[model samples]
Target chain A: MNIIVCVKRIPKTAEADIFIEKDNKDIKKDNLVFALNDWDGYAVREAVLLKEKFEGEVIVLTVGPDESKEVLTRCLAMGADRAIRIEEPIPNDGRLIAETLAKVIQTGPFDLILTGVQAEDDGWGQVGVALAQILGIPHASIVTHIHIEGGKAKVRRELEGGLEELLEIKLPAVLTIQTGINEPKYVSLAAILEAEDKETKEMTLEEIGFSPREPLDATIDQVSFPPTGKRAEILKGTPDEVVGQLTEIIKRKKGS
Target chain B: MSDIFILVEHRQGKIRDITYEIFGLAESLANQQGTSFTAVLLGHDVKSFADDLSRRAPKVLVIEDENLEHFNSVLYQKTLSSLISKYQPSLLLMGHSAFGMDLAPSLSVEKDFPLVTDCIGLTFEEGKLKATRSIYGGKVNASVSLRESKGYIATLRPGIFPPKMHGEIKGRIVMEASPLEGGVDVKKFIEYIEAPITGEDITQAEILVSIGQGIGGPEHIPMFEELAIRLGGTISCSRPVVDRNWLPKERQVGISGKTVKPKIYLAIGISGAFQHVTAMQGSDTIIAINKDPRAPIFSVADYGIVDDFQNVIPILKEKISDMK
Candidate 1:
């Protein structure tokens, strides 16, 4: 069996301060630590797990610039057989990205394809399902569980308000994985160093048949810091002093 | 027709609030464009939903089938694709929930419609569709515009568009046969598992002591719980805490978890991702304690403490107990 996993590199911004770039269309990436996207880590781990159990090859794929190759190497260290990087300067649109991935993925009658439900940076959650349509294959998104059963995949998808639905799809399908599907295993430093030598076959958009014929559907006009809905009043003084003030305020407010 | 259509989303026999939320946006946009908005519902024996939706828009389209009782992307996609071909509307809006997250992108691809997902704002500028989407865990917002297209598909995030009700409005109801020929056989539905109620329901709590990743670890949970006990409150948490097994699913407050509007919601060590904020922003009074002054939670908080929760929570707990 041949399984393909898609991953992307994103900045760790949840805990860090992010500043809008001077262009107002980008963020300053200098100080932020970059790593594989949170959900994609589970996707790669699931791919490796399926490969280990079913005796298949796990091929990791990424679409980005040179630095994004780091996520591919991480996947390789996590037990993927090989890596592929489609050189970047790709458009920011999801359809264009899906089309680009489809042009290369059509090269195979592969058994399964996996991707994160959404990228952390953009969070559009569009590419994988769009890729499945562009490829004309069955697809499932936000899948939380998977069990392979003879030429088909039985999967559970997470729904809103803590509900889950189970379904079965034919082989050669796409599954956009959600976080918590599996624990992303940790690899030692030596393993990562060894995997750095593993092959990461590179290809450009021209070589992969990406066309600029159709104009992009959507384009980012600008970006800015989110509007603070209603700024909070910061309590002043030491922790104990603040607690004393807070208790009074809580009592005042809690009483009506 | 260049009309706007909203896919009426329903579950367990009731129309989801997101359906109405999208309708709220479409109604105004349709008025601005001098065009009508329609609500297209797909369900089984759910004519009541269609009737109920008719009061919200100028038109309501019902496509009923027993097979559509539960959402299967395959059947819904096929049905929606045919309907789009027939109607050729300019826009079809859906909630960016699990349903749209699974259906909208793929259907947009299949129909060759320009698509946007998880939008917080949508407007037409110079006859072009523009959208506002929050990125980077809701720390930033991006304004995006779509190129000219015959039609488009977009998913709006929940709680962004507030649904408004007009006391008296009537709409035309149109019923169509299911466009899907024969049931979808390729993908078979198994079952839906509802979240188990392992303990207390946080939604009913009057006061909530909500914790996020900054709570440190499971070992520190009792300390937070003790604080909750002192204040006569229940313990709730952001998704990460539940994902880490620090709390049960019932105690989680977020988009995927329970939406709670307590009397007092004291958030500790939470960075207020939109997912979590959308759930608890309705609290009567909100307080946040996080060391990071830049945390997004502070924006929505009514009161804030910029000290390490380790510093404030213990003292606050002691003070509340002393008052009692």
Candidate 2:
């Protein structure tokens, strides 16, 4: 049961100070830090666990320019048998990326494909499902647990209101894994050094027969800070006095 | 023929609230384009839900299939693609819920339609549709537009649109049958296991007093629980509390947890992350108490107190008791 996992490189959102560019069409990348997206870490771990248990190969793929190779190498250190990086300077468009991924994936007879439910940067959560559709296979999103038996993939999908749905799809399906499905393992410096000798492959858009004659299906027009919807009325006083004022407001509101 | 098609989403024979929210956007867009809108329901034996939905729109398109009694995206995509090819509505809408998130992206790709997900607002300026979506963990908003296409598909964030009632619009219902042969068999549904309601369902609560990692330790939970009870509310916490085994999974509030809309919410000690804020920001009133003045929670809060919740909770409880 060979598996292919898709990964992406994103800015370290929590540590970075994000600001919209003067053109309002992009973000300021001067001091921002980049790493493998947090959610994709879980995806890579899940794939490695499956390969370790089932005795099959795991291949990881990513789409970006030169810098994305860092994440691909990290996946190899973590236990993916091989890594593939599509060398292309693409916009942050989910559909366009999914198309390129589908073309590259056509080269393999993978039994399963996994991806983070959403990227931390754009948070589109669309690429995995769109790839499944382009390849004409079944897919599920927000999957928290997965078990394979007899060429079938049984998954637990997380739904709103604390509900879980148990589903089974045939082999060769796509699953967009949710966060916290498992605690991703930590990689040590020793493992990173060992990974330097592993196999890493690179492909171009033209190599994959992906030629775009038209514009992206959807693109960001402008970016800006979210409006401070309602400025909070800051209650400034000693704790006791402020408590008194809050109590009065609550009493009046409850009465009305 | 500019028409909007809102896919009616339901589970276990009960309609989801997002189905109504979609009507709000569809109505506004339809009015702007001088066209009609249809509420499309696809399930087994959905007559009652279709009837209830007819009062809200100009038309309801009902499609029934035994395979659709439960949601399998393969079946939904196949059925919806056929419907779109036959009708060719200018716009299609759905809720950005678990089901919608699973279905819309694949459908858009299969049909070569432009799609956008997790939208908060939509506008038509100069005859082009622009959608506003959140980025940078809800700290920024990006306006996006679709390239030239025949139609567009969008999934709206729940609780963002204001649902309106149209008592006078008695809509007509058009019925149809499944178009596929034996429903595509890419996947099969097994069962739905609802996480047991260990305590109150936080999503149903009117008032909620929620805590976060800053609650310091497990021993401090009882103090906040008492305050919540006194204030006629229930206690809830962020995902970390549940991960720490300090609280039950039922009490967690966030994207992976539960999306709740309460009348009054008090966020105590929670550093406002987008995952946490998107779940509770729909509350009618929000009050945040955190020692750090720069906590993101204060930005969306209606009232803020930059003080230790430990000192503030006790005094606020005493004051409420005295008022009673």
Which structure among the candidates has the greatest DockQ? 1
Q: What's model 2's lDDT at B286?
A: 85
Model 1 ranges with Cα > 4 A deviation: none
TM-score of each: 0.96, 0.88
Error of 2 at A29 (Å): 2.3
Residue A25, model 1: lDDT of 79
User: What TM-score against the true chain A does chain A of each candidate get?
Assistant: 0.94, 0.89
| Candidate 2 ranges beyond 4 A from true positions | A235-256, B199-209, B213-235, B240-247, B255-264, B268-285, B289-296, B305-324
lDDT of 1: 0.88
Q: Alpha carbon lDDT of residue B232, candidate 1?
A: 87
| Model 2 lDDT, residue A140, Cα | 87
Summarize candidate 1's per-residue lDDT along B204-302 as a digit string, tens digits. Answer: 998999999988889989998998888889999998887677888789999888999999999999999888999999999999999888888999999
**Predicted complex 2: DockQ:** 0.55
